[model samples]
Target: MTKIADFRAMTPDQLSDELLKLKKEQFNLRFQAATGQLEKTHRVGEVRKDIARLQTLLRTKQPAA
Candidate 1:
């Protein structure tokens, strides 16, 4: 799980990379759940929140229009 400060410390490129990784993880988790193979179901919520946090940070980092 990434802390908010960690997200803040990242370059935009790194944040994007992490986001992609998390999204892939999220997909796998869902696949596992659909197959009735999911363990640590808590991970789903954690990933969802992390994705939200990362996206929020990304939005803030965007250049002004």
Candidate 2:
């Protein structure tokens, strides 16, 4: 998992790709939880937080037209 500061340095396209990857991971985590296969439930929260952090960084880095 990448840090928020490192995420902030990424370009918008890169950030979007990262967000997509994180979302996919989150979905898998949810599935694992439903199947009782999740060994690390805390990872779900971490992925959610990372998603939010990436979004915030994307918004903050957007240039004013």
Candidate 3:
């Protein structure tokens, strides 16, 4: 699992890619949970937090108009 600090240091494109991957994983986790196949339910919270962290970093890095 990647650290939030490391993610914050990434370029926008890298952060974007990571965000997309995290979203996909979140979807899978939800599906697994619905079917009672989730091995680690805690991972869902971590992924959601990571996505939020990435988004926050992206917003902070954006140049103001």
Candidate 4:
């Protein structure tokens, strides 16, 4: 789990990598939920939030047009 401050400290590339990982996790979690094999159902929401956080931070770090 990464805090907002932690995301702030990461480089754009690192943030993107983390985002990709989270998305993959989110996909797997969704599959597990569909198959009734998910133990921590709450984890799906957490991963979603983390994905959003990383995307927000990455967008903020980008140069304006």
Question: Of the candidates shown, which would achieve the greatest lDDT relative to the real structure?
Answer: 1
Every model: Cα RMSD to truth: 0.6, 1.3, 1.0, 0.7
Model 4 CA lDDT for position 39: 100
lDDT of 4 by residue, 1-65 (tens): 67788889899999999999999999999999999999998899899999989988888999997
Q: What is the lDDT of residue 51 in candidate 1?
A: 99
Off by over 4 Å in 4: none
Instruction: Tell me the RMSD of model 1 versus the true structure.
Output: 0.6
- The C-alpha stretches of model 3 lying farther than 4 A from their native spots are none
The residue-by-residue lDDT of candidate 1 on 1-65, one tens digit each, is: 77899889999999999999999999999999999999899999999999999999999999989
**C-alpha lDDT values of all predictions:** 0.95, 0.91, 0.90, 0.92
Q: CA lDDT of 51 in candidate 4?
A: 95
Number of clashes recorded per candidate: 0, 0, 0, 0
Q: Write the per-residue lDDT of candidate 2 for residues 1-65, one digit (tens) a residue.
A: 56767987789999999999999999999999999999998899999999999988888878976
Candidate 2: Cα lDDT at 38: 100
Candidate order by decreasing lDDT: 1, 4, 2, 3
RMSD of 4: 0.7
Better model by lDDT, 1 or 4? 1
The worst-scoring run of ten residues by lDDT in candidate 3 lies at: 1-10
